[model samples]
Target: EAAVTQSPRNKVAVTGGKVTLSCNQTNNHNNMYWYRQDTGHGLRLIHYSYGAGSTEKGDIPDGYKASRPSQENFSLILELATPSQTSVYFCASGETWGVYAEQFFGPGTRLTVL
Candidate 1:
């Protein structure tokens, strides 16, 4: 099974400042994704990677940067965080990008930008 972990589970950032959220997976899944969901909204994809060194823009890529330096590490960066960007961020890993690929989600990073 996939075991994903995220760091600094909770964060508070200032407007126009920087914030970084990190994620690591143990199961060696080939696909990794970053998502943000507001209190009453669905999962909004921020970024995704098919493998190391390859990153793709998802549904909501603006104001976010993503890095996949290794097979096990993926990071989400907010260069200039805004209050509107604050939300629960999630990291997920999957073996494939098909319909049947069950994504394993890590604990969310709750960000509060003031």
Candidate 2:
């Protein structure tokens, strides 16, 4: 089964602080993604990687950066956390590009920037 896990399920940070959210997958999939979920807006991708050592910016990558150092691990970094960055973040993994590629998501990490 494809499984994704995230650490620090909930976080409270002060503005301008740095925050790092980690994600790991056990499915050995080739694609991993980081997204933020906000009320009324569907999941917006922040960054994604096709495999290790390849991080690509997604639709909303302005205030975020991502890293994929190995097949099983991906991380999202918030250089200067802000109140607007407060949202639920989710990590997902999927197989290679295909018509049927479906992403399996982690529980989520709720971040609150004060």
> TM-score for every candidate vs. truth?
0.94, 0.96
lDDT of 2 by residue, 48-98 (tens): 999999999999999899999999999999999999999999999998767
Task: Give me the displacement of residue 12 in model 1, in angstroms.
Answer: 0.4
**Per-residue lDDT of model 1, residues 62-107, tens digit only:** 9999999999999999999999998999999997757748999999
**In angstroms, what RMSD does candidate 1 have relative to the true structure?**
1.4
State the TM-score for model 2. Answer: 0.96
TM-score of 1: 0.94
Q: Candidate 1, after superposition: displacement of residue 9 in Å?
A: 0.2
Best by TM-score: 2
The whole-model C-alpha lDDT of candidate 1 against the native structure comes to 0.94
